[model samples]
Target: MKFLQWITLTCTVLIVSCTSLFCNMAYVTNEGSNTISVINTATNTVAATIIVGATPIIVAITPDGKTAYVANGGSNTVSVINTATNTVTATIGVGSNPTILAITPDGKTAYVINRNDNSVSAINLATNTVTATIGVGVSPFFLTITPDGKTAYVTNEDSNTVSVINIATNTIITTLAVGTLPRFIAITPNGTTAYVTNENSNTVSVINTATNLVTASIGVGIKPFDIAITPDGKTAYVTNLDSDTVSAINTATNSVSVTIGVSGSRPKLLEITPDGKTVYLAYEDISFVTAINTATNLVTDTIEVGPAPAVLAITPDSKTVYVPNSDNNTVSVIDTATNRVVATIGVGSQPLAITITSNPQPPHSLAGKKKKDIFATQTDRINVITWSAPSEGISPVRYKIYRDAALTNLAGMVSASNALKFEDHNRKNHTVYSYYIVSEDLNGGLSTAASISIS
Candidate 1:
């Protein structure tokens, strides 16, 4: 008799990216309707519509990929959404005009930047409560956390300075003066430097993390509002809102390498792909998105989306890009392979910010452990392989087992299936055998064996 047993999996607590070996989901905050639209990455459709706090402007997912923290600009509160069910589990009051979110790498806490209150609210992820309220600079609108999860950098628009916060103490340790009306902040992958976009000064201030001082101020186009760094940490792209242009900064030289013009589309914000090959820019008062090639620093193509696109988010595999149109009340899914709008998902009115839940799925195991583990056995004329089918966040859509290490010959398969175990009958006795198992999540994200030999 042939039999296969399925093991249930409990996902890890970290949410920065999907180590859970599952597909990603994009969450978009709708300011006009006090709701959030969840998009399924695979189908590019609205999976769920969740009501949140009033006038939510931005969102951040926890490291465990379980919950989304949303900042309500109008209600002065933060709504915590349970990603598994697409529901707002908690709503905690914050400062006035909470506009931005920066979650720590550890996923233990989230920092909310308040524009009118000149403060930051720290929420404890485990408890869903406001743990600390730290005062920052005047009118802080955007913030970024260090890769190490130790410090946070906030851009103060009214004071023209950047506030540096020590995560351990939840306090503003220092403030460094930058250009006029600093708006957005981004920290490099190496955690050594930070880039702040100064809107009024039309420049990007490069700050040394160790000294907390501006090391270089590279001039960009008019009203630089957003910044994105390449994965390799070699370049920085700044969107100039008024100039309708983007300035590429050479990180090594701390200078502007190229300025690509966006004709008639005032670029408001930009996000880079995971592979760092392209940059997607959202235009103000425009109905389309512009894709820029990072290599040539030129406009590669323009994709027509909805009216007045505001923010952008990319999946972990760099295969798709999500753009939320505030005016048209929808999110456009763009396939990176074609650079075309593959699907138009209806979200909510005035969708503002978007983020993906993330990569790194693991092989199947037996105990539903967060990490990878394997179990198999062979007896006279019978072979059985049983593993804990990772439910991760979403259940595995299908599972496959192979006899060879190369995974060429399909020994068994569960189509549109969730069976975790595979049994091979009529096998030769006293023969050495090897097998490989692969799993796919509901979001269409595949996690395969890194090595041909199943671990």
Candidate 2:
């Protein structure tokens, strides 16, 4: 499975280009109505409409497709929706104007961009709570993590800089200055380079991943609002909102090879299909989407969608396109083969953003375990801890070991494939350490912690 990464352009304008492996459902966030429209992709109909916080601008689904985190710009809260139940299970309060959220590849943590407060909240997926908050530059909006899940790059609009964060510690390692008003960012498939769009400077800053420095600044159209790289990482397409054009940049040379003029007034946001065959551009002023052929760099078809189509999401198979229309309070489903609208489903009022689940399956019920056991032994300087899964409940997929009795300090974790064992190397020879073990499943369910003491 391809690692799911978060891509955000701005609070008002953003695009999520994810390679969902088994995507079968689409979740659209309605800004005006403060609700979510869940569309079953197989049936092309609204299966459920869930009410969220006020002015929900963006929504991100976990890689497992079991949970979704919605950023409420108006209420300064993130609504966690359980995909299986189609309901908001928890409402997490974050910084002011929480506009974007990015989940880690393991589905264990989520980092939310609080634009108004200029901070990022790291949420623990297991507990559905904020674990840490890291401060960043002024008016930060754009965020994208590296492919390896080790680093995250954030664009600060007012500061004109990019904050590089270490994923494990959730701290800022460095902040590199970029062009003025960096709005959108894209990292290559190889995790070697990152391309950031400067809205005010009318250029894109290319950064070296190894050095974390601005290596080159390539000039583009009037105002580059959003950017998307092809799956192959050979070319990156940038949408120029003011110039009404799309600039194709060659990744190898870091130069503009071709500039394609778009028909609409403001070509605001765009997304390249996962198959790398087509690029769809959404216009802010017009009611249609212009499809561009990546092979020829030419406009292929202009399909009319609902009025004010704010964002677009293409399915993993590249067979369908889903666009959320903010003005009409509906979603337009387009069949990719024919480039036509197959169905228009009514949703909440003013849908601003949409994200489809990669594997939208029904929720599995996991019974609680009644008994579990853990044993620890000292070998050299390492405390080797092993546990036995309770025979009372369903089979567990992984185990988490905590050092503190509060279970807040994580000691180590071992997957079921790792023989259900964890080694703690930070043990002191003369001190007694209390360890807690919790068994977990793929659906984010945790068993009661079993305690053990080692001296």
Candidate 3:
């Protein structure tokens, strides 16, 4: 039998709370309603509607997932929401017409882009106040925080330039000229490169973040509005509003790798799944979310959502997708596994951007275990091993041993109570055999380690 078939099955349960067994919540900023929407991922429902400020154009969640900050363009203030309570805990006054926001990795600071002011506001999370404002190029619309949270890159919409800000000092370190009307920015996972979407030029500028310079320019679709980098940092996805398509950029050569067409009229926002296998694009006019296969660069599914789906966000597990509909004042939740809309949650008007907190998966304890003791008879045959289990209730006492990475030995879960041993008889006498073990919970959460080598 295949390894996937041998795993035990468990009932899937949905839980809604501040602290979910899985990180399953969505934060949406509403521009028309002047508020933000908090959605429960499990139920695909709106838990709360928070009144933030005027024209909340974009929203960003802190790295720790404890708080969400919304940039209100009309009011020039950022509304801080406590994710646990789904309430606005504070209102931080920032620069004029804050259009986008980015938070530091430590979750202690935030950078807000002031479109009209042409400045970035640095907010101290602890005090919920703006500590400094750094001037940049014209119409700084979007900002991206580096992985290390030491710097922020802002895309100047009108100036066709990118500003690099030193987060620690709250100062503009340098500015690099790029394509016309840069609208969105994203940094690679390794923090080595940054990608900027040029709306007017219909291209993306690849910047070397270390030198704060544009290294290359890749032509994409018409009017690229938003951008996201794959988890591996090898590819980037950009949403083209005018062309109703998504452009995939290969980071290695800094060029357009592929383009996936969408059904909707204007594809405004884009997000990538945690596993980096799927990309989600939100269509603003038709109110739909299109799921694209990253490997194939094709639209695999389209999910009907609320009116004017403006933004999209995916949960840490990549099992759920949340979309904010600006026209209908609602948020739609899509179960990725089923490729269907599970629920439509009503919220404030004109929901603009959405983000989710990532839940931590249980650590694999077997990672540090010695291979020789774990697998004596079965080693050298397997190249890879994987284990997964559920996230809650009834701790898995132990795991079953298997020969081969595919677990083709010992039919099913054997009692680990007996020194967690498994033997291999199918292998030749002189041939090497490899073995592996996996621990899982009742909820289908599994943890896996390396394979054991034996001769």
Candidate 4:
């Protein structure tokens, strides 16, 4: 009888300097000041601020976390920031008023939504230049790219429609009429379904990405402005602007699971932690943020931030959160463990949105099994392991394979290649052995693991 054991260890680390004072950074777009604030998360202070175009509203970071793209609504251009230098490296003219931005999964292209012109600009990341211009519904306010890097969905606020674009051709493949005014969109982790929040219609439109059709229209709180789905893709939380409540919907049944009321404050935007344990809400009319426990669907912590917090983002470690206070031009840093404001860093005038670069994530669908070494003539035994590249975030530079479950026993390492596989040669028969696999990015940040055992 033979026994073989396998274990996958996901080493997810923040891609930043451990030796230097600065580790992770948060980029905030200042609309009133027309600049970007770079906040160092380690010290909880502002590292630098770079000037950009007029009225920057949104920011998107590439998968590698080396570059940032800012949408300047007033100047109708996109400014590219080199993260290493913290400077404006390039500025590409987009459209009349670019309000939203999204980067593809491959990190090669960026799509900018110009609300006034009703068009989208595809910018090539390599050259930092506009490569294509695609038209969509009127007054497109938000955009999201699928996990496969093949399609993009845009919500047109004025036209009450969603424009589906093919990334390869840079053209609108279809336009589906949705609720009265679709303001924001969120895609599930698997990229199988997209949920669109219609502001005027007060309904959530669920779309099937495969057929590009509306699967269900879920009634929710009044004037739903923003939506975010859990990492597991099981539940979605929608913030109702006017009703001062958040509607949690079960993705499986497309039904409202619970409606948590924020009686005094109006919830403007929200995000769920990567671990899917807590849901944070930022209010436009108030100065505090509400943290809800995902398991119990109840309010766990109410943290006081700056005046009129506009938007917020959580770090990959799920230990810290950064919220841009639009009224005060400052960012409130909250510690996840205590749910208190640890520091407040002054940014620019009217900080609207924030985005942080992510650490490399573990490869998907990792599996391994014992097999015969066909190329060898000595009747040797081997273990062949295979996986798909990470769905998003920083790409790995190499994969390390360990012989022991504790990951202290070094076996071998493989470079990131198209093969997406590793092999352990000359394995002993009828003996139990364990293998551990992890991904390492260029900056030496390790990924979190997914386990797969071989018999």
Note the Cα lDDT for every prediction shown. 0.78, 0.82, 0.72, 0.84
Tens digits of per-residue lDDT, candidate 4, 83-110, equal 8788998899989989889999788999
Clashing pairs in 4: 9-449, 10-447, 10-448, 10-449, 11-446, 11-447, 11-448, 12-447, 12-448
Between the candidate structures 2 and 4, which one is better when assessed by lDDT? 4
Report the C-alpha displacement of residue 335, candidate 2, in angstroms. Answer: 1.2
The deviation in Å at residue 390 for candidate 3 is 19
Using alpha carbons, what is the TM-score of model 2?
0.75
Better of 3 and 4 by lDDT: 4
Writing each residue's lDDT as its tens digit, candidate 3 over 313-429 gives 777667778777777777777888888987778877677778765553332322111122224454322222233432432244455555555444633353324444443333343
Which wins on TM-score, candidate 1 or candidate 3? 1
lDDT of 2 by residue, 1-455 (tens): 22322222111111122222222678899999999988888787888999999999888987766788999999999999987799899999999899988987767888889998899999998999899999999999889888888889999999999999998999999999999999999999999999999999999999999989899999999989999999999999999989999999999999999999988988988988978999998998999999999999999899999999988999866878999988888889888888999999999998998897652221122111111122354233455555566553334567767776566788778777766666666445566666666665554445446666555
> Which one wins on lDDT?
4
Runs off by more than 4 Å, candidate 3: 1-23, 361-455
* Worst ten in a row by lDDT for model 2: 7-16
Tell me the TM-score of model 3. 0.74
Looking at model 4, which ten-residue stretch has the lowest summed lDDT? 13-22
Q: What is the TM-score of each candidate against the true structure?
A: 0.82, 0.75, 0.74, 0.79
What is the Cα-based lDDT of residue 44 in candidate 2? 79
Q: For candidate 1, what is the lDDT?
A: 0.78
For 278-382, candidate 1 gives per-residue lDDT tens digits of 999888877888889998988889999888888899887787889888888888889888999988888888888888876324454432211222335543344
The residue ranges of model 4 lying beyond 4 angstroms of the native Cα positions read 1-22, 362-446, 449-455
What CA root-mean-square deviation does each model show from the true structure? Answer: 6.7, 15.4, 9.8, 7.1
